[model samples]
Target: MMESMVIFHRCRSLAATDAFYIQQLGLTLWHTQPGCHIYDSGYGYLGFVEAADFELPAYSCISFNCTDCAEVDRLYEKFKGMKGITAPRRHPQFAVYSFFIQDPDGYTVEFQKIVKEGEQ
Candidate 1:
């Protein structure tokens, strides 16, 4: 089988960034170097490196899917004291409960849980 990974181009604080994702977001560090690192996201991998000129784009770029609203809620509470977090909201049109969080470098990560039929 073919293999691939997701890598964020640049980062400011490698330790801080790694801690947030690994400790707070539950992603695990899989590899590391002086200015680069990769995370094990269970299903795949995520990586980042130091870059002085790095600037996050203005958009919701990536998302993590949870089993349900309760799971998303649990994560929200755990991360509420952290940096960037948008309160959870439900969208009937999309049948989803979700929120947004920004990394230390300003990159946005979305958390979502799908509402099964009749729940919407």
Candidate 2:
């Protein structure tokens, strides 16, 4: 079957960006190059590239589903010690826990936890 995924950002710091997603967010690396890092997003992939001269428009951001909202909050807090961090908050649209943060290049990231199969 044909496949596709999103390259969320053409980042400025390829190494730093890769480390953030790999080491911090814990996304498994599918592949890596001098200019890019491909990550497995379960159903697809996410890539980060070194784009020193790329002009990016205002993007809405990508949401990653998590099983535990508290775990996501914990990670958010742990990552706060690093440079450029944001606090996690609840999503306004749905009844789920979510947190918003920026990557190395100021790309918005939403980590959300959806309700389980049987619970409300």
Candidate 3:
């Protein structure tokens, strides 16, 4: 049985990635440094690392469920200039409002708030 959870992203710049997830997405920071940062995203722990340790995968996106979709967009807009976050919009498949942004390491991070259930 899986007792705990962890998601790690191999990034090119840990500091930038940390800031985007922490500052932009408003995720609580568990640990922070130049090459690594651990964040508590209310659902699980997310770790961002910058090292020649893991092979970079094809462009992947991670969806985070939030309480408020509006706030998600607000924070994303705030960090858009500082962190170079791209504008995010609604996700058609999930019937949820989704904000898409690129992390410092160029990983697509989607902040999604499901508005309704059983959306196609």
lDDT of each: 0.81, 0.74, 0.71
- lDDT by residue for model 3 (1-120), tens: 996688887877666766677776778888777678889977789987787655567868787776777767775766566443556667656577866666666567776678766542
Ranking by TM-score: 1, 2, 3
| Candidate 2 lDDT, 1-120, residue by residue in tens | 857765655878877777778888888889877788889877678887788796555765767887787877877777676554556766567777777777767777777778655643
Best of the two (1, 2) by lDDT? 1
**Residue 63 alpha-carbon offset, candidate 3, angstroms:** 1.9
Among these predictions, the greatest lDDT belongs to 1
The worst-scoring run of ten residues by lDDT in candidate 2 lies at 82-91
lDDT of 1 by residue, 44-94 (tens): 788889887877765545688898888888889877865678899996578
Worst 10 residues of 1 by lDDT: 53-62
TM-scores, all models, native as reference:
0.83, 0.74, 0.69
- Model 1 regions lying over 4 Å from their true place: 116-120
Candidate 3 Cα misplacement greater than 4 A, ranges? 31-35, 53-56, 80-88, 117-120
What lDDT, from 0 to 1, does candidate 1 have?
A: 0.81
